[model samples]
Target: MKESSSFGNLWQAPTARRLAHATSQTSPADSHALGRLIGAAWVVVAYAARGVLRGYLGDSMQSGGGVPFWRCAFGVGMQLGVLPALLAALCASKGGGSPLFPTPRRLERWNEAWLRTPSGVWEWAFGYVFGLFFTFDLLLVPMKTNVLAHHVVCLAFHGWVFFSPQRPGLQLVIAGEAVLEFGTGGSNLSMLLPGSDAVRAFFVLAMSASNTYGAVLTVRWLRLQRGRWVWLTLLPTILGILALRQLHVVNEVYKRAHSPAPP
Candidate 1:
């Protein structure tokens, strides 16, 4: 018992100690700067991805139902940039002494160094997502009410993470939502290159695989007990439902892509 207690103490800082460290470490400005830097990098990557995809995908890219290649590339850039970071963050947390299952302490440990501190992989992941969605919803594409609502919910949640330091695991919740966003990659690509049924089918299959991964993340997220207030959990639940609606649309698109046409 004494040995276990000694190990536990070494394993994690006390809550008061962690709280003091989180508050005293840095200003929100510093955290936002990290986020902004990450956001700006995604913009640069979007431009680069546009050039790369245009080079590789060629004229198949031109039939995007009036959506430009740049817009399509933003989705691609997000997949290229953000998914890896989220996977890395999850791996780091899981490997770095977090329990395999979701406990309150596990949740706290998952965010502590990565996100609760405001300046590491979680910031990188959130900033990249915020940049991609902000650019797509506000700058690159036409505004749809659904997209706007998801964006607002995310922004609200992001605010919660920054302001409500007591709720460190909120970042993990947002990260799960971000995984759901990554599941849209195939739909985005299919919309962008509507003429290529082969490409569309291939990416849709890829999307199914990604959504399966997201589902695993969601299961873990749902098991977490911390930061489970109605206001805290409600918006993200709505966000996931919205994502399910999009998945339905993507399913319809896939069926259309594969269906027989009139003789």
Candidate 2:
């Protein structure tokens, strides 16, 4: 009986302390409720804005030679609308429950091991050298040019992945698009002017990257937390952006393809 009591105390004491610590660290339930309310409100506003833009500008803006109206609108919705909504949802969902944005445990372990590996050091050195070349290209070249902009953005996003709180998995998708764009020579602005191969590749890569990442992040966030309402508000905005950007790329490609070849 004494041995049984000792064993029970040994395990139960730590469990009790952990529970007490968790309760002390946790935010008030009312605060979480208020956060949800605010998040929902932001989603409503985003939805309304999307409707207005689609209804008023989507059709008429198709006449312009630049990016399609719907695509531009969708970008606005995702960057401005959806991002905020996600942030709000995250705030609402924060507490002692299992973290929605829990750090990837295996990734942490891998990173520790990677740091100790010679190959990892070599890879890091290579990345730094390549990064310097890329940075030089950005600084000296006209990034406003269509080709450069695509590449620069890709590089920038890659850099962002290493430091940002964002998930590496998400960054991998974005970086993969950059790889695809690089392969296609999609960064030439002159091509965009004449709708060249580079231009088509740029648009396709950029639009596809954005759409894919936005959807992936949104879905991941929703699955980890009770935020389907927020995702519902965002999915359309992402799809709209993808469609518009795709159309712009196609139109440009068609125009260039049909134009008279150089004499």
Cα RMSD (angstroms) for every candidate in the order listed: 8.0, 19.2
Residue lDDT tens for model 1, 132-251: 665454654544466557566656755655555544455455555555555566667667666786767766666665566555555555454354574366646754765665576676
Q: Candidate 2 overall Cα lDDT vs. reference? A: 0.41
**Candidate 1, residue 116: how far the Cα is off, in Å:** 6.9
Which regions of candidate 2 deviate over 4 angstroms?
A: 1-119, 122-126, 145-156, 164-167, 170-178, 183-248, 257-263
For residue 132, give model 1's deviation from the true position in Å: 5.9
TM-score of each: 0.59, 0.32
How many times do residue backbones clash in model 1?
0
- Best-fitting candidate, scored by TM-score: 1
Q: Positional deviation of 123 in candidate 2, in angstroms?
A: 5.0
* TM-score of candidate 2 against the unseen true structure: 0.32
153 Cα displacement, candidate 2 (Å): 4.9
Off by over 4 Å in 1: 1-35, 43-69, 82-106, 112-125, 128-132, 195-198, 209-219, 222-236, 239-243, 246-254
- Return the clash pairs for model 2, or none: 147-187, 147-188
lDDT of 2 by residue, 1-263 (tens): 11122322332445444543443343444433443454455445545665676576563332333333543454444433443333222222221111113244532443343334312221222233334435544553222344355546557745653334423333223223333323223322323233456555655565556555545544543343334653575356445544555566566567767989878
